[model samples]
Target: MNYLELYILAAFFVTTYGNFLDVSVWEDNPEECGRTRFENTTLDVADYSKARVGQFPWVAMIGSIHPDNQILFFCGGSLISKSYVISEAQCGRLGQLVRLGSIKAEDTEEEKDCDECGECALPPQDIKVRKQIFGNDCSLNSVQRIIILELEKPAEYNDFVRPICIPTDAFCHTSRIRQRALTPGFGHIFSTLVGVTERKEKFDDMRYVNSAIVTQEECNAIYPDLLKDGEFCVDYPKGVNHSCVGDTGGPLVEYLKVKGVARAFLIGVAKINPLICEAEDTAPIVYSSVCNYSEWISNQIVSSIEAERKQGRRLFAV
Candidate 1:
């Protein structure tokens, strides 16, 4: 092997290693060591309306093993069916509870304005969870009729963060479908102050991170085996906005309804392209087709609503 041949071999190895890492491994901070390891490119994130990086309103649905409910399974879910906090079963280990809604999503002077789900100028809505019932295995939760997380507002359904329609059919085909609508509790955001400063000091610039919907085939190539048969993935755009530790349980929403919950939060599986690993860019993400499990979700919704009615009639003494 001459020097030139050796150089060619070295270049080939380098390119192969980079590509291999691209499809499977990522460096959260390759500059750091331990936290830096192979991660799924398809993870989601959570936010605090603009108040903080990954704080309140992004609840972590914690649970317990012996029914005492201790382990914290922090998935990001919204107040949509505040009466029934929806999330993934595998992430459900038992006695789960919601967390921090203290922070408000009001906008800072920099970002100017947004919507109810955004940086609304007014004080954001807040509530304490009276009770929450997600399936430990949709079967058992159904048997015991305590499904509703019990909220007092159907009025919450005006425009921002209302319950999206659940697909009537649960088992839909993912084989050839190319596009989908996805939503997440996570948003790639910069403080409104930052936006203002950037505008004032530098050229006009806008940067935010939110989840996207990608094709199954493209996602499959990058995420060849991370999913377990029926499961899929979703992500905000890349960079500071992609779904991170807090956006679990949040909806992978589409149209104006709940299509899927962000399971990537607790599941901890993603594999992003190294080139786009930390850029303020967007990439269509994937989601577990909840449409495939429509019947199961419907049963939960039906059972919960019926019980709510019966309890109401009983209170009225009808």
Candidate 2:
């Protein structure tokens, strides 16, 4: 090929796929976590409906495999690292398989292709749970309902599967209060009454809702007994209901600019609410504060790696 022709071809390639190439530098660096490879340029963050593929790559579906080989997903969680997922204690007993990289709730195929742009995602990962570590104050009555699930192997990173950043000191102090955040999950989308039977329709696709942070005093007025020191609440927009059944243990994320790049941070985990789907409008959702448990999370991960090394097993090298 002539030099002039080669230069033209290279320019066309850069113009068409420059954004994808720009983020490749962070693909292997654990320190540069929480950035999505595929940017959702179409949808606005204020949209409170179905989420676009590759928008929130760290959202995980926690489920169990039955003896008949059927998977029953009952909860949601966030992938904090290649080897660990942060969830609630209630989900610790329920999670046998942690699914990542796909938005579909039930699909036979290993990989999902985006219909909008004709881009194909890597195969979805169904990693086994090697261990379940509960928080120090985890209990039925306590608001500290945190649990960290250790995956049997490190999840391979791709355009659709990556880790969300843990909250930094600055993020916790500045961005977590009186600010709107996002909660994503693959849960019940809606319900209907057929004759006498009220049937709740499970969502086939993942969805997200934008909600505002509720102050402790405001949340206490609603559930005084349930609101505790290490917990916070978020209220959905008017006429919008979210964080329903099967969403427990999912993440409440806050987006902020880090070094001129937009990034997401894990701020809260969805705490189980009995009236989640029942009260459509007025119910404020509670979440376990990830900021308060940051130290505990770090300590557990360090100890878990040590324990695994003693037995000749190496966890994901994050």
Q: Which stretches of candidate 1 lie over 4 Å from their true place?
A: 1-74, 79-82, 90-122, 136-155, 158-161, 170-176, 180-184, 187-212, 215-221, 235-246, 256-286, 305-318
lDDT of each: 0.32, 0.69
lDDT of 2 by residue, 1-318 (tens): 345433443443334324222342222124436788754222334445766667788988887789997887777888987788998777776679999988777754745646345666667889999889986665665555788999988788777888887874555666556787777887622211111112155567787777778888898998878677888888776656444633778888777665567778788888756445655455777888888887677667666655766889744443
TM-score between candidate 1 and the true structure:
0.43
**Model 2, global lDDT:** 0.69
Residue 148 Cα positional deviation in candidate 2, in Å, after optimal superposition = 0.6
* TM-score on alpha carbons, each prediction: 0.43, 0.81
lDDT of each residue in 1-318, candidate 1, tens digit only: 345433443343344223212211121101111111122123233321232222222232322223453233233343323343444432332324443232222213245334334543322333334345454445522322112343333223222222323333221432324233234332212111121011111111111233444455666776676444445555443343333312323444333111222212211112222223234553433334454444444454455455756688421100
The best candidate by lDDT is: 2
Judge candidate 1 at residue 111 and give its lDDT: 52
